[model samples]
Target: AAGAGAAAGAGAAAEDVPEVERESPAKAPVARRRRTVLLAGTAVVAAVAAAALVVNLVPDKGHNDRSGKQSVGTAASESVDSSPDASEPSGAKGRSASPSASRSGSPTASAPASVSASRSREAAAAQGGDGSADGATAPAVAVNPYKWEDPCSQHYLIDQNPEQVPPPPAEPDARGWVNALGGVAGGQQMLALTVQGTGKATVVLEALHVRVVEKSAPLAWNDFEMGVGCGGGVETTSFGVDLDAGRPSLSPKAGQRDFPYKVSESDPEVFYVFADARTHNVSWYLELDWSSGDRHGAVRLDDKGKPFRTSGNVGRPAYTYPLGDTEWGRNESYPDIPG
Candidate 1:
């Protein structure tokens, strides 16, 4: 019975060890491993979701910022293109627009204002009333009124040797008198005379003589004279001859006489002479003596032919010399005569 009791105690001690306690050690390890795996999976899922969110948010924000910049650029470009005054000279426009663009950082806002300001400045400069140099306006240059007209268009010459003296020879002689005094009075005379050489010069007409000659012999002679009254008069008693001195004078019967006249290289003075011829039936000739400063010269014209011929019809009661045979020559015509 003591042996039965010992077996019973051992059995009781075995019974005190619970079935759950024995399984606890093996199951605890498996449960703890599963819990650790679940926590690690949850952490991995959270990290992936966070990474995706950051990627999406960052791109969207960047895209929005880029879109804003593009919109601003487009608006600025449009404003610059559409502005009315923006077409001004590129340099000026650029300068003006720079300030506005720099201040506003918007192309649309600054370009037009800059262009307008530039235009205003240009307009002010053009008007010349203000915003100009010294407040003085430029003056218009004066033009010559007689530039296109012939100055020596109307004039004539007459033989003025004294009637008492014998007439000159038909052709020029060694004396230089007859040859020197032969030609139409106003024929081919210069409307403006060109004074050449150096220094200031004075143009002076010395004398005039007219005579009726037949075959190189004098028929009638008359010295040119001047009278108080100008224009038409009796041939023998007209202004061609001086009434007081009974001699000829170089001064023109009509026209300006101011001498030592200022002249330019491009423009010169023209001269003319006038006289009366109503008397003789024979062929006639004219003699004109002239001096300019130190230069002395003479011109002659007759009724015969070129380089020495009368232009006006001698038979006519009154005559005025044309410009074809004057001292300047036939090449000179109206308007070609320089100022």
Candidate 2:
């Protein structure tokens, strides 16, 4: 089964930092994970990433007590890059400097929200600053990015003052709450993408690659819970990455195919990527390789125009505004999601 919540963690900072955002998909949004990777390992684990993202907590008193983390994809046109790379993708730990990207061909693409800046520069520099960080997408077949979730999709808000955060209503606007506070998604970062060929041609999705733009010490921030509960199964071509690994690779999950799928305007394929970090806050994105007829190219998927971020928030001060609760309280317990 899959978890919920869109996530992007920032590196350690002195005090208040602006939040960024997370998503877009044209084909299908697989069940947006409510939990992070720890919970996705098995339902019995519940969303360990939800309440149990054991990371260093922010100091009890500071500006971060009122700041939020960055999220992704609030606005943008859905289209393939103008110039596509014909080379195959290598979404692995040892990826080359060459870059790839994916875009949506429609304006109706939807995604979840979260973000980071210094890491952005690092990612651009690592990629040789060839405009990949500027959101200048190339042209190829159309593809959608982001997992499936609504405005109320569960998420974690780091280092926000409980006093300023409004009380939870009957149905708390999770996304709106995070956005208002400028908090980022904590724990794990999950991504979903819809890829297809153009016109009547069937585009072959050769491979999906992973690139780590930057890595830093995990943020030490107070954890605010948005996860109400978790329920769902992995329904797409699922893959996993361990951000803590010396060389992380995009390995297929249990019972999941690696890549090499087929799609077209009439037929599209959706992929779910689960990434986790145990020791570092990481900035990353995906690259895809597609070919139709004699023309083939690669596409890069990121958070709006920046690299998506995620971190391991383990034992931070976890809090929640559970159902029926008017005020935010300590997250003393977690749910046991069925596998």
Judging by TM-score against the true structure, name the best candidate: 2
Across 87-196, the per-residue lDDT of candidate 1 in tens digits comes to 35566544443344444464431332233323433554565423233212111111111111122232223454233223322221312433355323222222122222
How displaced is residue 276 in candidate 2, in Å?
Answer: 1.0
Sliding window of 10 residues with minimal summed lDDT for model 2 = 70-79
lDDT accuracy of residue 316 in candidate 2: 64
Residue range 1-339, candidate 2, lDDT tens digits: 122222222232312242221123421244345344446677656556544644335343544544332111212211222334343344432332222122232332342111122233344455565233233222233322334343124345466667666764232344365556666556656676665543564657788787889999877666665546645667557888888888788998868877788876667676777787756788887777655444445666776656777766765666677777788777667321111
Clashes in predicted model 1:
39
lDDT, candidate 2, residue 114? 11
Best candidate per lDDT, number?
2
